[model samples]
Target: MCNNQLTITNPRYLKYARITGNPVHVYSGRDDYRLRVPCGHCDDCLKRRQQQWFSRAHHLMKRMALRPDQCLFCTFTLKPSVYEQAKEKPYIPIRQFLDRLRKHPRFREKDPITKRYRYRKVKFPYLFVVEFADGKTAAKRGRVSTHRMHYHAILFGCPLYWWQVRDLWQGDVVDEAKGWYTGMGKAEVDPLESESGVRYVLKYMTKDCAAHQYISDVDARKNGKLIVSHGFGRLSKEDIKIMRKNMLRGASSWFCHFINNYRYSIPRYWKTACFSPNEIRCRNDSLIPGILRDFVKKRYPFPDFTFQQQQQIYNCLLWP
Candidate 1:
């Protein structure tokens, strides 16, 4: 089994909740929601963390580790609803800026393609904040580069990485196209359609619980379900079924769904740091794709890989 536990040994985790009637309200950041007993949220919060629950318990614990939610891939913040609404209402960010553009004598669209594109009305549609059920969205990131995951690509759109690389934010995607990145990982995107007529790509990051990264479609008429990656490590199909069943039972809000969605991606990133004696063996053995394997060579110390390992990397990047 993979070790997906979050640490919470500090009494600090307990403080995350405020006791209320039968349902405990597990609170984090500025949000609160209902949960049942064994209330892992509560247990991790109050009970001294048992050497785990560290990251899950409190962002403060990391001291050095910035909150994962702050990262672009985790894009827990940013409201696409607001931005879209402003566009719909003709509410420009600055009246003067709009006026200047409007006054230009030849203001009509010149490009036939641009003019052919008709606009649609989207209320409270900031751009993309994962389509909240309640119509509420989080604050947008101050800068495009710093936008969190959901907010990152929402403003642009989720490519779902039809390519070999993954980008945390829309701003970063351009750079990726130009061959600039820390490293690239690929995975097939499974679109989990929700009742709300929306679809989300769920996957766990290397060091985070599941996070909602992409929303493929949305229809206001239906409720939505989260789309998560297929499997992780060596779990048998039965194990995955059991875990999914348990996860659904304990799930409370969209947050739980986020974890449920990407639960598989987390452990797969864990490597022993060294699996071969000689450098060539190690480089050839890495899970990175042959296309990307060149990366390990001049990019970083080569990690070993075999033909089978190369195929495995390809399978992951090309996941559905």
Candidate 2:
């Protein structure tokens, strides 16, 4: 596996993790700490990993025309997971997150509310299957078992929506949500597997995911700028909340309201304020400078709330 930021081929999707020389994570699945390899790696790269990768979702991952006795990896025999040996990760209760997601204006599940009148789907799906390398390199090069089911539907007035299925074995309880119309191809070029079919095959191979922690400290002004550059003028409250909680650097409660709500068609918001950041070195073309200019152009187009309101808005340490 190339540890120097190389790709044998670009990943089919935008977000597969890199294969590495270092063992970076811990999982109950593996007896040892392993380097996480993405499913997109070439056969040569994966062969180097010496792993027995399997998935219960799309059988294609294991459907090569090989003898049953043929070794799965380096002549090692395939030992299918029995209920006895497989260690199931604790299930994440989806109720709360699902509830929160449903409340979003964008929430659209394929049910009666959506089936009759919903017209279209999202331009982009939010569900992602992030792969990471698994196992030691010098000692034992390895590939991550890959697959995570992604869902899409336009059945409701909510219209476009997507979600990911992290565990398929739990489907006995989630059969409704697990609904799928398989056999459709994802790409025109594939025979037994079209792009969608290949994607369907890949959805079953999820390696244990621990990468969510890595996203906990994402830069906001930088992230937000990317969104703005894409031409979106406003942000959701959740975005502002993520900003204020320090997940985003330099997030202020006041700025949160203006940045998250005020649309960009109005240029008076940050047209002339200080474009430079005092703390985190904001990213390139960070519209923050432009935004500050807009704010300045509007004479700091901000609220001058009553003292009581101000006190309630800002924490004591931030009282200004």
Candidate 3:
């Protein structure tokens, strides 16, 4: 009988042939596959990563039985102060604002009726996705144009109003504030009760990479740039390290075995063929008893032959 090598083709064989490789097909279900392939953090790769994160978020929310109204969807935009407008990098203040929102969301308010002091805070268990723009695109006639950097976040277990949420970032500053009160930069909050809102918040995630406007361009060390958050589907630094450890790199023997085990489950879109070697090497075949070899061939005569023929036929089809 033919050995395991005759099953699916190795990725190196296709790479050496200089053929355009298909996306890495990760089977998620009986007929569902996720296309995940690295592309130097380009538009396509960034988009795939966003989709992966969104899927994780969706699943986590579903698993937690979170109702749409239980979550608060909001956008926090940075306003240009007189001091911030003249700076070369206006995103610095924006980053500082986000840091304050994530870490220290405490603010003080005095009750007009009772003349009592009250301090409140918006703490963790939140999800925020950030996007940046120069506002040259959103500007209209008679409208002021300025640098725009903001975040689209989902707050869990907090029912703060739009204005109250705005105050958390733009309130009295003798205490501490991250934003301005001119309403130039607004915080729009809405109740997320449907799947459409989730999609809307995540839709523009990878568009920055497409336009080459990475948050890293503003500040290389800034956190909460791409997809950052706490609670629910939050992937921490340690989680990322574990994931990286489990990730398979380039093609290897284990990869071939993986392909073989899932041969029947492989999606048709996945390219699976080998190319002829430039310098073929001869090796002795393994010794098998004549009776056993005949029995094996009789039982599995077509197992390996079909895949070998498939590779040969595909190569022929590629030739002009």
The candidate that achieves the highest TM-score relative to the unseen native structure: 3
Worst 10-residue lDDT window, candidate 3? 279-288
Better lDDT candidate (1, 2): 1
Index of the highest-lDDT prediction: 3
State TM-scores per candidate. 0.17, 0.17, 0.46
Residue-level lDDT of model 2, residues 1-320, one tens digit each, is 33332322223211222343323332224322233344533443333221121111112222322222221110001112321121121112122223333444444445576465332333211111222212233234345432211222111111222222211112223234544222111111112222233233233232222222222232111110100012112324553344345323432322322322431111212211212344324432354455444444354334655545544444321221
- Per-model C-alpha RMSD: 22.7, 23.3, 15.6
| Candidate 1 residue runs with Cα over 4 Å from true position | 1-73, 76-130, 137-168, 172-223, 232-320
- Report, for every candidate in turn, its global Cα lDDT versus the true structure: 0.27, 0.26, 0.48
lDDT measured at residue 195 in model 3 versus the true structure, 0 to 100: 57
Give the runs in model 2 whose Cα sits over 4 Å from its true position.
Answer: 1-125, 130-276, 281-320
Better of 2 and 3 by lDDT: 3
Model 3 scores a TM of 0.46
lDDT of 1 by residue, 1-320 (tens): 12233433333334433333222223433221322223222222222221122112121213223332222222322234334543333223223222332333333334566665332322111122222222223333333332222221111122223121122212133254543432221212222222111212121111121222232223221112221212212334464454345433521321122333543111211112212235323443443345354543443442566556655655654331
TM-score (C-alpha) between model 1 and the true structure: 0.17
